[model samples]
Target: MEKSHLESALPIANERNKASSRHVRQKLAWALIPLTLTYLTFSKHSPHMSAFHRPAINYTAQCIQPSALFPKDTPELSKAFDFISTPTFVNASIERLSGAVKIKTETFDDLGEIGVDQRWDVFYAFHEYLEKTFPLVHEKLKVEKVNTHGLLYTWQGSDATLKPTTLMAHQDTVPVPAETIPAWDYPPWSGFYDGKYIWGRGSSDCKNQLIATLETVSLLLSANFSPRRTILLAYGFDEETFGYHGAGNLSALIHSRYGDDGLAVIVDEGASFEEAWGTVFAKPGAAEKGSTNVEITIRSPGGHSSIPRDHTSIGILSELIYLIESTQYPTRLYDENPYFTQLQCGAAYSPEFDPKLKTLLDRRLHSGSDETSTCMAKHDPLALEAAKKGPEIKYLLQTSQAVDIISGGAKVNALPERAQAIVNHRINVGETAQVVFDHLTRVAAHVATKHNLTLHAFDGIEEPSSLILTHNEVLDPAPVTPSSPHPQTPFSILAGTNRAIYGSEIITTPGIMTGNTDTRFFWDLTKHIFRFAPGYDDSEGKEGMGNIHTVNERVSVVNHVNAVKWFMLFLRNLDEADL
Candidate 1:
């Protein structure tokens, strides 16, 4: 009886297993319909999605066609061509530059490092050299000294009704480190001229501009080129360390004299016209990146290293720095960024740009948030390739930072009670000092919270160690300059001069200054502050060789001559231009 019941149960179990398998197959068949629809939906939207969604680039005044960036080109005044002389005065100019470089008129970054007794005598002698070198300029232009080192010369215009223009340069050169003297091909202060070039500290970094301005002005005055508008030659003594002392004092004096927005334009030593691969890119640093030096110091209990805690002051500081350096500020595009505007102008002119690179740049720049991740993924591989190929171009696209200096661990036995890191930021054109501060605050807070650390101020307040402190107080973002094309605009006038000199071979456009200049103090004086120091950016788009602020600093004598010519032409054309 038991065997018969078992046989019946086995048959029933087999029937139930077959029913379960059929039901699962029916469910899978129904699921395929939605899966196919979902895949189709994703494929349709793939072109619009971003792996990390953000706003697309804004085409700014700087990015649009040349017509939009500036007004129509004005007729070139013939007077500028009168003095268009070849670099014939090369030897004499080189000699003059060498003399200027020979003077050890060095400016220190820390004001305290410069002593009252060490007050520069070379600067006074340099003043005497200028007086002796250019008799006509000395006799014609009224010269005023600001704080001893700063030099201001006003070539009074026949017409005072017009707003005056300023030609700017710095009088001082960066100090050569005592240890690096052996590395120089010659004494850094020798101002050694080997016929082809002048080797010294300031040959490229500025004294060249000072000498060139004088050379141009002297030639102009001698030729009876009386200016319709007054032209001032403003030279600062301290620009390398941020232009506060030299340019600050001079700016105050000028502001008091001229009032706000009084000048037609201010021309200073800045970014150069770079010739690379048959394309000449004019980098007139019309806009300078905002700068702020941030300092983050971590503090904790001091104890023997042998009896260390889970974390120490140095460890905490290191972790914070890692967070900042490893994770960079988000890359964003702004229409106002002059750097991208420059690229837009460059791309318009150059056939050399790779088709794919151009396409990616244009797509990314002109694209909107609605663009799909699939679209980005397809182009991103090439976009990233383009950036890697031209790192200089990449630098223009984003706000940059570097952890320049760090200090901690005074002794091997004692755990560090304090550690500090100095991070320098060169702000993108549209961003502000506040944005940088906010970034620092956010990063600091995260690190503090994670480690149970606390921040303390010098005054006495103590809390989490997330407090942000500036190495040198805080620097307000520098004012933005627009070099829109107009007969009266500096860039417009500059373009005429560039055409006169370089012809079609040279392309001039407004670009951003990666480093800050003395122009910071003179922003209120003019909206058109054009920074074009006559030099060449090399093949890789670096500003000349690594000679700037390094050993064996030098520039060609021919460049020095060309600089003088450019200055003369710009001044002559500017004189005749109607503001």
Candidate 2:
């Protein structure tokens, strides 16, 4: 393929060199304070908590705790729970499983006959099942088919004036390589429930969310619980492969319907229960870091091995790599980046942490880590070790980036004239791809005086998005200040959802997401967008988490029941509010 316009527009080498040198000097000067703080923080270590007072607590009780934070219980909640828990609903779910099996069987049958793409066949089969089983929903909802890969369903709200809420889930599953785990206790696609868990491929990555939303809406419809705001369900089929068919088409469709007035909230599959300090935080996701794929290329005159040039392409590329390794991005402990603060706070609350350190952990940001001992005493021990190494290490602790690909040499006897490397970056909050690219460009140019190197960004900027709700909007401007005490300004944090798509209208929070999902697409759409799933933590530790997107992917009988109840509560609370 020809070089893109971006690749061809590499700036003059001298300019980058000068800029890089200035940046390096500035970074070196500013490094002293953090370096001192790091030293002090690492010097001391506190004793561990007693075994009897271990911080870890049961997950279910934590979730069911009576808290003023959530919506007040409605009479409908118990009814909803009862219906979901009943044998009739369980049987209905079982029948739905059988239906899914038949659909998959038909899909395989058709694949054998027509030789269609397996992914397309699976999507078609799921689509057919939805239409047949939820005929009433199809009739009432505004449904549209996206070409080849996805479907959209919109339920117009009772109040025509209200904005819409979108629920997203992907229909696709990552292909389980045939050679990898050959035998399952039950067939992978059979959707068999063994009294405790359901076994299937797409079970947790999405089908669980899909079933929960559908069943929730179905029960609400049966009870005539009409929403005041429009609701949209977007089901995509190719999320595993860049979400081209699913979220891409759905995003276009949404843009066409709402324009810049934008969506109210986009709910997607991510952010749920996780063991934190031995307790379940049930962290909800609010925003995600942006991603950029960059390419760095080096070129020079070719030569025979017997007469190599003073600076060959590979040698030049090596120097560029060294510059990147040495240079580091800044780590600002800004309050807007709340994930770290929350983690620190949660750790402080844990019984596992020493009581003497609790006060430091609670106000660690304000104290500003006067010394390495104090900083280490307040934060995670692992994080402290990483911070001392420099900005590159610290940056990865918060965001994502990888030098994933590289290529150079051609023949053994001849020196290659060109070489290249690709760096994939996940932009942290309050950072832009352009900034990262500029930093790289300057660094590469500075090192290229002895070689010939060119740097270019392969992908455009994907800026992070956030939502921050306010009550009177007259409070102090401190970034770490808690949200207003208004129902509209719920005390929630953002994590793994695409709420950034809507821009400034919505107030956002920074949520830490440990895994990647299809929710990234919504960052361009709405402000109040959040990634939340209602399921109690299973007691099996890491194995429980592994079940998701794995062989025994399942939502427990109890969790499936609670999911319906929780969804109803969320909908009711959302509907009653102006937000």
Candidate 3:
């Protein structure tokens, strides 16, 4: 009996040993899988690594790499950060800027066609203050008044072989709407400072950049630091009013002086990013969407209310609006669509991002930075859902249309003789204004034919613009800012400087700006235009959302100080650079 029991125990113990060995092997395999993939990842990035030798390597895929995207930082970087963040330096800088904001330099876009020159005395006073405040800048730089209010300061650098750079800031600011006046924590026009905050209009939108620029240049002059490459301080009087006279005239002046392709790079105000998802990203605006306003009209003979036709002019206008809302611009995402690449980059690099989304994006990286395909399964559902929930996402993906104004009926119970609307369109990449116009006209014609009414795209306020067919941009999308692509492009100069000043805390990506800026004037002047306003506001819910063009509009004091430091450093860095 003892011998039989021992044989049975031996078989049981043998089975247990086999099971433990299998479990160990399984765990080891799972651990080795990640190690193998990581090795393959590094191997593919290596110059000498071959796909044949390492079959698992991602040989053709471009990744959302962190270190390689930006230039290596110099040892002086430590001292640079120290100089900007000091309390004494920052405090003094903010106090002076707060005083500058106290001057109300509001610009009003009037009557749809003409700019209302309200508060001329205030503008003149602001101009005088700039001269008084920045005496060093006024005395050293060759300052000229373009259109009286616009300040054109030229700091002629030592070398002409190096292409010049233009740093732009607008003198004018959008008027505070009457409806939002009550929302102001401080008076909209009162540029008040109560210890920490600088209160008022123009404090954030652009005045922060404008004032900071003057300070930067003035201090540089005080230090006797002259640039090696020519620097232009282009300030626009009517940037808030579309910059026709302000930036437009400045562009003409620049062209006459330096010929076509005059500027090496132009940095204007538009957008910024400090953090996104679980990661941080620093970006100056790369490209912006195009814009156009189409004035649509339907006309009919006046008829009595009692004896009205099947549909009135006003009814038809509403119908048209419905049609536009229903039939949105086609949702097309191509390889060249600028926003997609940035979207992909965000999903792939951000640690907090959904893993499934990252996997999808990584699959497309095989096309080497170009989005290989617009994954139908992922995008179709998201796009449809976003259309109902978030218009902002739709706006980024495709051309967007907004039916702004509709006016028709005059007296109560009277049949309307005419009805009109202004449909504003933000033209998308891979589409044109003409194409959009044609689409609208075609739809209008079809609708009119069905209703038996006369439809026309008028050129009047209530009419269509005078230069619709003749001019390419009839309130068309703003010119997309040009990019001098990476490694050693004109944009790399700004990128390098940004990385140096801001550091590698954020993964920077190029993206399309939603709105227009003064940089529109410099389209032909330079192939490289970056809409970058360097100010970080931890208080403002998000970057670029800082109450700009809104009541209670204000920027952080530290940001203003940083702007001054950034420009001073950027100019120095650019001077030292080969470009």
- Cα RMSD of all models vs. native, in order, equals 10.4, 18.8, 12.1
Q: Which stretches of candidate 3 lie over 4 Å from their true place?
A: 1-84, 111-121, 363-389, 455-486, 537-544
Q: Which of the two candidates, 1 or 2, achieves a greater lDDT against the reference? A: 1
Worst lDDT window (10 residues) for model 2?
466-475
- TM-score of the candidate numbered 3? 0.79
The regions of model 2 sitting more than 4 angstroms off are 1-78, 94-121, 181-195, 303-319, 322-332, 344-349, 353-397, 410-414, 452-485, 490-510, 514-525, 547-558
Q: Rank the candidates by lDDT, best first.
A: 1, 3, 2
Better of 2 and 3 by TM-score: 3
What is the C-alpha lDDT profile of model 3 across 1-579, one tens digit per residue? Answer: 998999979989999999999999999999999999988776544323433353232421222333323323344543444555787767766766777778777766562323253454466888888888788888889998876667789999999988888899887778777888888888887777766567788888788888888877776775666578999999987887778878999888888999878787787887776566677666677777778877766676676799888888777778777887888776655455555556565665666755444443444443244332435323432234323425665776678888887788898778988777888778776566876777787677677777875444443333321111112245444445444343556555555556566675555566667677888778878867878876655454474455787777877776677677677667776676675
Clash count for each candidate, listed in order shown: 13, 25, 10
Error of 1 at 262 (Å): 0.6
lDDT of each: 0.72, 0.56, 0.68
Global lDDT of model 3: 0.68
Per-residue CA lDDT of model 1 for 1-579, tens digit only, reads 799999979989899999998999989989898998886666444434331343544434433322212122223323433433434466567778898888887867655533364655567788888888889888888989888778899988889889998989998888899999999998998998876668999988898888988888877776667688888989998898778778999999999989899898888888887753346777788787777787777767788989899888888888888888886654544556675556566566765755565555555454543232334433333224445646475555456789999998889999887788898887766677777777777777788778876543333454433443555655554566775664356677777676665565577778777777888888889988878876442332443643788988988765676777677667766776678
- Deviation in angstroms for 505 in model 3? 2.0
- Where's the lowest-lDDT run of ten residues in candidate 1? 65-74
Q: Estimate each model's TM-score.
A: 0.81, 0.68, 0.79
